[model samples]
Target chain A: MRLGKRRATPLPELNMTPMIDVVFQLLIFFMLVPHMTRVNKELLELPKLSGTEDQQESAITINITRDGQIIVTNEPRTVAGVVEMVSEEIRRLGGDRSRVKVLVRADHRGTSRMVNQVVSALAKLGVHQIRVGVEVPSR
Target chain B: MRLTSRGVQRDRKIELAMTSMIDMTFLLLIFFMTTGGFMTIERDLDSAIKERPSGRAASSDLEPAIVEITRVGSGYVYRVGSRELTTARELTDLLRKFPNKIDGAYVRVSDGAPFEMAAAAIQSCKDARFLSVAYVPID
Candidate 1:
């Protein structure tokens, strides 16, 4: 056991390399996935409220700017175009209208007519699983 | 320099500055955690004004409450089925007071009314928990 006594002491630390790599990967993933949320591209300030949460991964998000411009996945559309796009999206989902979920993220300054028009468009398409995004309440 | 147990001289321990890095990692983790990136989305369903409202959705047997939100210049006016009100709080109170009498909650905002006002109207209707919510055309 003299050889053991002569050896240098090892650092008794857990190997964190893999854990750090995973954390970095997660951070990058979170950063990239938010773009899918399109929260960055649409500069519309959403309505603020102490709201509940909804878990709908298959929802289509439509952004309505303050000046009444409608946006779907970064492309601009008119209120009427919104109907067509939603219809296409629903058809894209295998035409099961009930499976189509729509999310409307509008600027607080957006007109009620814009909101109404979106609702009407979805209504006409027979898709009622519509969700509207609002800001998190300030505590 | 330190001496080994074998009576040989050895170098001092090479310390790693991992404490600071771990602190920063934890800080980042906390940031992402509280920011709710994990949340699917914060949204609410507005199932109003369906083209085909479900059967057994008749509000005629029960008194329906129609809320009119009108845009007047930069402000707005709130009316509960012809009875004018000023704030959404008052509207909520009115609906809450006669919960049994009101079955349908329709939000009819003027064409130019802001979404904030419309959202407020929806919020009040939700608070009242009306049986049915319909969207009426702005006249």
Candidate 2:
């Protein structure tokens, strides 16, 4: 066999399998790691209950700051104002009482008296369907 | 001239451009990874427990148990159905004594009771598996 001079070139072949594997790994990690929570009050240090995870929606939301001040969602409300607003909200909800749920989210350092006052006021208005938003990280 | 089969196979290398798609996927994965901790927890409180009428003792036969937590200076005072407990140790002991079944508990909280005391009280009642808890704030 007569041998002829041949050009020896290194093939620029990039391995696509590893790249695809890494991409899918990252995609799955992001998807499974997420916990999409809807309530957006500030970062209140809520107590950690072992595995008590209850998911429910509220008609109105209440936030009790670390210093124990009461705010109905974004607005700071006085006891009288809160009562008036809640009373009106009840009337607005009219037929579907199931929709009228009050969520109380209090800071871990927040006093319960303020929460008590709010609950008492709601009780007076005859709205008992209430949800206490808690912090449930795997303890 | 007709190309041979070997010539045709090596003549063209078809590749789908994946650089931009990989970049976009990486960006999304990073976003979700960083934002995974925004997890919120929701829990429902036992609905509208009828507080005992002011004049009448709670349920003549049952004699509803009450857990009183009052803040005194920087310290806290706890009273469980007429038994006073000044320390957390004592409170734990008292809770351990709770029966397997009970009607409900009335948690009487004072405005001065800080979150620590209030949380402890609520937790104790919950540990006892008390059916319901009514929070009453003393002015």
Candidate 3:
């Protein structure tokens, strides 16, 4: 009876060391993954508009800075270079340019000429529909 | 002897209270997860670039409404055909009153015009309920 009473008296305590380790690992992962994925996105002051649609996944992202610089996949490219890169991307998608979706994130303070040049190049490649990134105005 | 035994028992009871630490860690994890999802809350504005035949113009009545955006010193000027406007709000109101709404609208952005003006022009066209908005690059 004494042995049974002693066994019941000791409550089971959960070992939190392993759990804490796993939680820490997850915290680190969540912290690092976003930074890694955002490497391709250049920091720019995007245009704000109230009538905007939800952004969808795109096959390519072209960033235009205030100085009229264009960056694609984290590499700066000229208008012609951007055209070439987009064409290559289209070819990789089984030579179907229509299947390719392009996202253009242009700085609000940048000249329209840069965005226009990029759009013209994309148009020449038969990629008509393009997504322009903008910030949703907070009401 | 009794005092020594009590001290030993007290030392055993003074464990690192991991409950609060675990709770805080979980709270941080939840916070990071929720905020990380919002890091990229950018929306999209869809624009189309149609390839017109080399030397063909649509009929006069079938032409798309053109909104010309030009930079004027420190400010910008928005022109939808002959009517000139200083603000995007006025542009939206004018486009809303336009009669022919089927052909959509063409936003012609000049070289030096800022991108915000162009985006605003497009947004105005959308706010007016145009079926399509085309970005026209003027060199």
Candidate 4:
């Protein structure tokens, strides 16, 4: 009787399907997550209105850039010009000037006086509702 | 078919090429890993606190008293409601004299004002120990 050694069986198993699925899932997550774009550096660091109820969205956002310039709707304007424009907008909106809300967004580096002028202008125009926008200060 | 010796030799070369394909896949992975670092965004302010005021927020009642200061050629003028303040001491005194009314005083500063002048206004508030001080823009 001739003894014949049996040939060893090679395991044929290379499963790549699970690994590819994980890589594709990670790619989808990165693609769908919204990236935080650039923020306006000119806006003031508003204090968080902790415990305050949600305010109406009627407030106008005015930004003040560093170097003491006023920007209304992204347009640079002088103090007087801003007042005039705000006045006209109030009139067109058909609301009581006293009821019109003014939200001032000024950079921290922006001088207090520049902000003061804008607030003074708003007050002169009879805008009674004025809220200072600030980022909530960390404890 | 007879035992194809040449075919077996070619098959060995193809097995070596599989190793080369894996090397290329690793190179691609490293390139992508390095490029993924470009998505970072820097923030100037720290964490934010959400503010939700309930009931009649006393802050809304705080009347904003504004002082405008604009850079003039080389100097600055401190104005209240358009009236220029001649002296810092006078402004400080005015802030001191503000009545302890139900609505706390709101200090609005203009952007055109110098940093020194703005600091003075804030200092005045600090000296008076007014807790409800709100710094806003004048435009």
Candidate 5:
């Protein structure tokens, strides 16, 4: 007598429910993670501009570069030279330094620290009313 | 008691490995420890020009010595009384004198000039120890 033949069965379909659940969980986990950042708050402070035309004849304008170069009245000057020249100018202006106003125009790329060096130096001379210049594009 | 060879049998059990779990925990711990703090840069008041209040007008008596900085090709052209300066030192020399001896020193900066040039000018004012600085924005 011949042995009975063994029966073959078809493969069962895969269940994708667990895989979808895992993917959704991972998405939620990543969304909850906080981003890291360092912000500068002091740079946001804006100075007041009196813009009085009457003082126009009394203000001194100073321009700055990213690398800390200075240009004044269409002339180029070194850091020390600028100080010396300003001192002499103050002395010559009837020896009244208080009447001298400084207007500083610096690039956006330059750090506040770089700008402060100029302010501190001016402060030592007992002059006040520092005006900073900003460029607003014409509408 | 001694076991008979025919009656003795070996059994093996499966368990999860803990090395991966330890490594993951260490990674997470290091990540949190190294990146939890943020730095805030303080605003230096001396570097900023104050914002003028609304509805304020310019002084009519002022005669501004307008020093216009025009964008020339890739660089900038500094002009004072129709004069141009080629060196950084020259700019400082002119700024040093400023409105002290002159009636009005108008500082008009171009939008295209390198920031360093502008900063140097401001530094010159600081060196001269002038506190009253005014900045004019160009179109």
Candidate 6:
């Protein structure tokens, strides 16, 4: 009779502790991811190319908008300012220009002159590993 | 009086109503998941910009193919040597059919030319099996 009475009572409360812990962890993860991915990326329509290469992690990202405005890390920078920033980055990398990779994200409708200015600046710094950001068409 | 005191002690056991907390957590989780997943993935195209040696004469025997991109009225024009092409397709075909491709190719983009055309020219050179494609910005 005691066993039957125990069974009649509601099921033992689920150990909500572990479930809550996992849920909170997932919430924190999701909260952090968007900021991390969006730090260097600016909203621009990149060129669509068929045989584009994969994206490698770059130390610096330069963005060029349709009006030929240059931005780095969300801050509008001139060609000279960009060079200064790159020089600082190189110093942080132990003065190794070879190890520093730069990614240039230019709007498709933007003038190539702007892209060229940034590329020329990087080349002058002797940083040869440059990547132009593009979007590959989804299959 | 003893039964009442026992009931008060049971109430003090702190039975947290977890259902509301769990519901809120799930709601937050779903919101973050949906927002985070909406970000678009971007890729990169590898490019190299090397500093040109000052006052170096071009060797006629080993000159790379140069594709000049100029902005027209509304569209763009691609010029390879003396040949003028209107579309990237034509340029690609012409580059592919070149008899001597020992040297890679140079994509010279003029001012006001859209980045899309320049990228397409580079992609065309690559598709034509050029060993390297150099981007040169011309004024």
Q: Each candidate's lDDT (Cα)? A: 0.67, 0.62, 0.78, 0.51, 0.47, 0.76
Ranking of all candidate structures by their TM-score, best first: 3, 6, 1, 2, 4, 5
Best by TM-score: 3
The segments of candidate 1 whose C-alpha lies over 4 angstroms from its true place after superposition are A1-41, A52-55, A93-95, B1-14, B19-41, B50-62, B71-74
Q: What is the lDDT of candidate 5?
A: 0.47
Report how far off residue B60 is in candidate 3 (Å).
14
Better of 3 and 6 by DockQ: 3
RMSD for each of the candidates: 6.0, 6.9, 5.8, 11.8, 19.6, 7.1
Interface RMSD of 2: 7.7
> Cα miss at A85, model 1 (Å)?
2.0
* lDDT (Cα, tens digit) per residue for candidate 1, span B20-43: 568767877886687665333345
The candidates' DockQ values read 0.36, 0.25, 0.41, 0.12, 0.05, 0.35
* Index of the highest-DockQ prediction: 3
* Per-residue lDDT of candidate 6, residues A76-118 (tens digit): 8899999998999999999999888889889998788788888
Candidate 4 residue-wise lDDT, B13-68, digit = tens? 21222454465567568756875654322221111111211112133222344444
TM-score of chain B of each: 0.61, 0.65, 0.66, 0.43, 0.44, 0.59
Ranking of candidates on lDDT, top first: 3, 6, 1, 2, 4, 5
lDDT of each residue in A26-69, candidate 1, tens digit only: 87688768656754247567777644455355456788899888
TM-score of 4: 0.40
Q: Give fnat, all candidates.
A: 0.46, 0.34, 0.65, 0.17, 0.06, 0.62
Q: Residue by residue across B1-139, what tens digits does model 3's lDDT show?
A: 1222344334443245587577767877787888765564588888887544222224343245788786667777987655679999998998888787877788877778989988898899989988888887776
What is the lDDT, from 0 to 100, of the residue A137 in candidate 5?
Answer: 22
Please provide, for model 5 over A25-114, each residue's C-alpha lDDT reduced to its tens digit, 9 standing for 90 to 100: 575467345332111112222222222222233245566665555666656566565567668768878768766766665555654434
- State chain A's TM-score for model 6: 0.78
**What ranges in model 3 sit over 4 Å off?**
A1-8, B1-16, B19-40, B50-63
Candidate 4 Cα RMSD (Å):
11.8
TM-score of chain A of 3: 0.83
